[model samples]
Target: MPEQTQDDTGRDRDDDGRARNARPRDRFGRPLPFGSAGVPRIPEDLDLPPAETLDYAQRLLDEGLAFNAHEVLEAAWKNGPFAEKSLWQGLAQFAVGLTHIQRGNAKGARTLLKRASDRLSAYGTAPYGIDSPGLVDRAHTLLMALEQGKPISDTDLRARLTISH
Candidate 1:
């Protein structure tokens, strides 16, 4: 069993499977739940190689840190070749969708997922070392589940999750 944390009123919020955190975090820069005053910018001089960026993104996603993974993908979109910018944008949006799922925002998740699917669909089966078809299928499945009221387990999103090394 997972450990539960106390809310402001000292109630066990996680006990009821409340993935969405309701407590407003502190305004100070000090670390609080879901509150970051500012995040240090990534150095523009540090160029992240495409393969290394993909590797980092894959690891973050596997660890269920899709939110962080989206940052990496977004960086890739901005820094990567112009020809592949859309591909990275699609992947970033997909990661953001997964982040929405983790944050318990079903509507947001479905919206971003559908947008990602539409963007990635242009790639067909493969693009930028990713299996676009499998990703599109998974996106569709999750979107449909949200639409059909199906229970989505954390691991329900299983598909081509790795990048070619």
Candidate 2:
């Protein structure tokens, strides 16, 4: 038989007396129940090269997997020290906004898309070149439609640029 200790509340304690084997606390010191702490951290060894990261983002976008593309690009954007960091960050935001649009959340999409457009516009053609300008324009167009309470028209959008979905 195992020996037990007694807590201040007269509860029988386990060998370690580790708060009665309760779940770990969060940053705010609130108890987080077991298995509810959310996703695990990404390993440092899993980091991809810049070119491969960008390729992953493009592939996901081309496959009509906007959410996955956003995740990939966002990770790259955050980790990158590229000369075109602002451009990539804006693109990542645009991808996330598009994901929201696909999910029918017009307001949320508008907010994120507007931020992307603004960031890209600030970079302008000087540092980000023509590509940033084009992305900003696309984001602006989408934001306008969303602000007007109009559904994004696939035909109209497709006419301007070729997005996978």
Best by lDDT: 1
Q: Cα lDDT for residue 9, model 2?
A: 91
lDDT of 2 at 82: 73
Query: Each prediction's TM-score against the native?
Result: 0.69, 0.59
Instruction: Write model 2 residue lDDT over 1-165, tens digit each, in one string.
Output: 234567889665666664342344332223466666723322222356666765666666565556566666667667777776786687778877877777778888888899888877886663312356666677888888888888785433321112222
Q: Candidate 1 local accuracy as lDDT?
A: 0.71
Error of 1 at 85 (Å): 1.1
Q: Which residue runs does candidate 1 get wrong by more than 4 Å?
A: 1-46, 163-165
TM-score of 2: 0.59
lDDT (C-alpha) at residue 62 in model 1: 78
Query: lDDT for every model?
Result: 0.71, 0.61
- In candidate 2, how many Å is residue 43 off? 8.7
Candidate 2 residue pairs in backbone clash = none
